[model samples]
Target: MKETLADDLNLLSAFCGVRDLTDLSQNALYQKYQLKKADAFVLFGGSILSGIDVLITAMNNQVATNYLIVGGQGHTTNALRLKINQFYPQIPTKNASEAQMFNAILQLKTGKTADYLEEKSTNSGNNITNLLQLLETHELKKDGLILCQDATMQRRMAATCSKFAPNTTIINYASYKVKVMEKDNQLHFDRKLLGMWEMDQYITLLLGEISRLQNTPSGYGPAGKNFIAPVFIPQDVLAAFYRVAKLFPNKVRTANPAYAKSLEN
Candidate 1:
């Protein structure tokens, strides 16, 4: 039997939880470029330390013609640059995050491919905006833009990039592995919950859902009209309950015993 639009949407909604919707449309554009061997790469960083490792690994791969590192303010960029030099002493380096154009001259001087840096951005949105401006200034296009960031932030970064630079291609190189260490273990006296790490998993799932939703064309539609249709009312209601419960734990405990128990246990 042929499935209705609502049916199909319901199925999709079940498979993927709450999402940003824009991810769906952006993914199509990402596939069109197929930037396996591009001329340049634009890498965004969540934090200087965590972001640098991915950048170094990308540089070592020699996949793209050059690299563009988007960094935060203060000593973060400097620290990252130092780390890169220490690790890959052979690879020539320079500090040009503030430079107007692609640090083409410095890149040539190093005898390696070109590398540019945008030091002004604090988050993913600014990173894409600055990268677009840099690309325009250098007469570059979407075919060569690869996005690199921490695995946790890749989805949001990609969504921002898609909105700002629709034509520009972005390839994500961040690994999606979350490592738990013994030091992270903690005890909860009141509820017996282990640690705050569970919160991170939920955030990750939410971000992933947002990323997936943002890729769809309908995901970019008006928020008031068809932003989120309830496919699974129970799950949706439960999510809402959890959100409120988080804010008013005591009130939720007095109000709904079942919900409080579910959330607590």
Candidate 2:
């Protein structure tokens, strides 16, 4: 039985992206910790407007007492401005950091703002590091955190959180769950959502996360760049990543030059 490309994509998406966090995903983890609510709900800044929308929904649902938006200008910063102009035209993004843009949308939608905004970190590694430092300076809760980021990077974010905030419990609530459907021999979303990514960009992100999540010597894990702690990668997930990577050649986003420099040290 020859499986279709879509089949592999489905498996990859399921393994990579997590939806809203709470009783639905990991109730047992919360029960074990006796956690009634997460100490904070943090949204990692990206081009996805839905991440901000969903994060605000979580806030309205009282998922956490503190809300933090973490990010500075990076690769996706300009793309995010495009989404802002398209979806949130009222919000000004003049020379704004990623966190600032997200905060503006959050405030416009909910009539409130984030408790803290860490606007200095430019990449995932420092996103977590700066967030921890901000938490310490503000005396914010670190017991449990519901983290929202791009769907492709959710699992990696959890691993990064575990490395930096080892004692804290993390709930990965990805901003979007990507679904690719084959039509006319091309992949497209079932329908466009706000802040939707182009198909090629989406594929690159999905494949790139697997590259980072691999436990090999060049991966982001402890054995690799040591950017994140070691986390188990299931065989099925690894297989799916390889199959899809083979199917879509050369679309994976490479690590930044900064990471290359770190590996040289």
Candidate 3:
């Protein structure tokens, strides 16, 4: 199957629709603010290496006083390890959990580490549950929370958090926003960021998320597995999804075998 320039644009539009990236600083450059720092920041480990740098920058801006890094060895573990090995050869990547890898970079770059870490979670569903359990165990309470996750999983993470912590203020600031561009009839990203997904894999991840986001039995919404809250998809997003799906009918991402074993619990 061949994809045209227009097809790629639709793919990109649909991809952006499901993603939410709030600006933590709102374009502040050494500006002062009166808002109190968030009660806590929650970082979800992922394959996107740029997230580490983004979170660090946010920390430098004094976004939060404390944070917890959450992730375990899941489908993205190998990719993260590979990125670390490729970029920072000295870092140990041997069987490193996502939180370990993220914490390693966070420490090396910023001379700091997360206040806590939830390393036993393998998927988004457990990521929230395990995070809550860890907080409760420590008796950590926060009226407001900040969520930093990979752009691909941003919405789902926030939705899951909202479901469990209905009253707490949930602020989303994704680590990266993957914007698709066009040049000479070609579809490409503006620049290559660290740990960037291959174009095909990025599209697969985006489309796969839509399937999970759809309000149906096969989705992660209340009608389905109840993994997250009900999501409303706009008409443009729906149209783009249909267009992109037509171009790549069989390209959606499948769950790793680990999901069945690890998430079942």
RMSD of each: 13.8, 2.9, 3.7
- Judged by whole-model lDDT over C-alpha atoms, candidate 2 comes out at 0.79
Compared with the true structure, all predictions reach lDDT values of 0.43, 0.79, 0.74
Lowest-sum lDDT 10-residue window in model 1:
256-265
Per-residue C-alpha lDDT of model 1 across residues 1-265, encoded as one tens digit per residue: 6533223323322333222222222343245554445567565544323344344445666556667766543222454455446544544446434222123222433434335666665434456667777777877656645675544445546656666666655565542223222223531112222111243332443333333333244342223212222222244433543453354344321111221121111
Better of 1 and 3 by TM-score: 3
Who wins the lDDT comparison? 2
Task: Give candidate 2's root-mean-square deviation (CA, Å).
Answer: 2.9
Worst ten-residue run, lDDT, model 2? 256-265
Candidate 3 error regions (>4 Å): 1-22, 26-35, 261-265
Q: Which pairs of residues have clashing backbones in candidate 2?
A: none
State the lDDT of candidate 2 residue by residue for 1-265, as single tens digits: 7767776776777777875444423354356556667888899985377887777677767777788999887667788998899888887877888999999888888789999998877778788888898999999889989888887778788888998889998887788766778889987777677888887787788888888887789788878878888878788778878888887888878876643332112
lDDT of 3 at 114: 86
Clashing pairs in 3: none
